[model samples]
Target: MTNLRIRAVEAGDLIPVDLPAPRPDVDGARWRRTRVAVADGQIVGIASVALSAATDSYFCEVEVVPGHRRRGIGTQLYAAVHRLTDPRFPVLARAMDSFPLRRRFAEALGCSVVTRCPAPWIDPPTPAAESWATGQQAPAGYRTTVIGDRPLAIVKDAWASSFAWVHRAFGAVHIDRIPQMWDQYSKGVDPAASAVAVDRNQTIVAFSLVSPDAWDGRTFIVAETAHPDQAHGTQVLGATVATSVTVLARRGTRRVQLEGHTTDRHTPDVMRSLPAVGSDPMDILRLEPPPAVSRGGCR
Candidate 1:
């Protein structure tokens, strides 16, 4: 044994191990703090789950230091998280299409492969701009409304449900942790910059969360989307995309990009339905686990 101990992350204890910035929503829900594994008093692994308000859906993230591979730290940390969420609601973890190790770990925990959306980039469409100038109005009802704190919960539920369906169809486990999603979004994106669409009843039908990134040179990244479930799903999706493009253009963004798994044709169709939206291929992989009799259980 490596004498590793798993415990909650404390104030001033986070030292920027090997993962991206700490997600905001996960951190804010002080009750659902992150868990870190340490060996010899040095941080070696980390994992955390953000529990959702609706049902037992939680979003999770895990990271193991480069030097700590092959040890059971990753598994242990995940197991501990599972225990915390066990007998409650199902937990879902989101791994980047490029992170194979994490994906494999998820599978080992009895998670199935889910739907993949492609990450597509969009520049000011010159040809489309010309067409628009000729009176080709932006997609109908494709308007953008600011996302306020009041409507966040509803929007989050809608987003979680949509993603859960897509993942389930692909045979992947679904954990819709709302707090974690909110944390990641709040830290990485600007809420004021995000927008949602509403029907006549003022119900939020669709939305797009966007973040401005300077590293990619004034780029806008569509963090997520939730379209209505009614007959207007396609239209709602189109309006959300068009509204995002308009917002990014006004902010002086040179380009806009949305990242998702793109192996499926439906992914491309979803993007194409929106005016000026284009698709391109991106690399992604899912690693499998060794055959075993025991499958991890979801809360």
Candidate 2:
């Protein structure tokens, strides 16, 4: 940690150190602060936190370059986070199951696992598209359209409303964060594969969001949902996914990846039936508050 300075900076400052571009699942407004551990004019570590209005806590992430790790750089960055952020609110962190060292590091930092969610990558058999082909038909009074063809405001609103039906162990998603989330991740979404179901009234009732894999060029179904208010919501959900698959298959995309969350009740059973080829589930950790000291005088 010698000659390292942990100073506050904008989120973009960490981009050089593998800070991912803003993600659609994460709301930019929730970002509270970011700090970089700079040494010799280069960033050696980074720590950032975003506020979850629903939980009233900060979700933090810290990283130290491979060469700089084990030198207390991460610890110092976190200490800087503690010094800058509100102490009344708790801090949370995430650890991927595939990285045992990450979990151990979180545990060593006095964090406890609060939730575990599977990040399964579903690679449906080529025949799955054929078997589910019939699902492409929209329910009566509903028609399917590509998400890119519709207004973003309309799509974002529909996604937020429909997602309310989902139950997650962590907590409900903040509707206010949907727009920014959509803005960040929508750029990568495949306009041709992502579809939405619209009612006769032109209201969006269901949607399937898809994107290409950055590494393999295959398709990845980012998200799919149907508004619970629709009488045929379930069917619409099926149709959207079916349509995406049919289109993908026609394009010679025999394999598709869909991430499933074990703690999410909304994941369809059909999706769960697919083989999980991704890393182990992710561990959401929370830093437990210290025990309260006695307020009364000692006897």
Winner by lDDT: 2
Measured on C-alpha atoms, candidate 1 has an lDDT of 0.55
The parts of candidate 2 lying over 4 Å away from their true place are 1-4, 9-32, 39-42, 52-57, 88-90, 128-145, 163-177, 198-203, 214-220, 224-236, 252-255, 260-264, 275-280, 288-299
Q: How many residue pairs in model 1 have overlapping backbones?
A: 19
RMSD (CA, Å), candidate 1 to true, equals: 6.8
Best TM-score goes to which candidate? 2
Instruction: List, in order, the clash count of every candidate structure.
Output: 19, 0
Candidate 1 local lDDT, residue 189:
57
lDDT measured at residue 178 in model 1 versus the true structure, 0 to 100: 45
For model 1, give the 10-residue run with minimal summed lDDT: 284-293
* lDDT of every model, 2 decimals: 0.55, 0.63
- Report the error of model 2 at residue 68, Å: 2.6
Q: List ranges where model 1 is wrong by over 4 Å.
A: 10-16, 19-31, 125-209, 214-233, 250-255, 259-269, 274-299
Predictions: Cα RMSD each: 6.8, 6.4
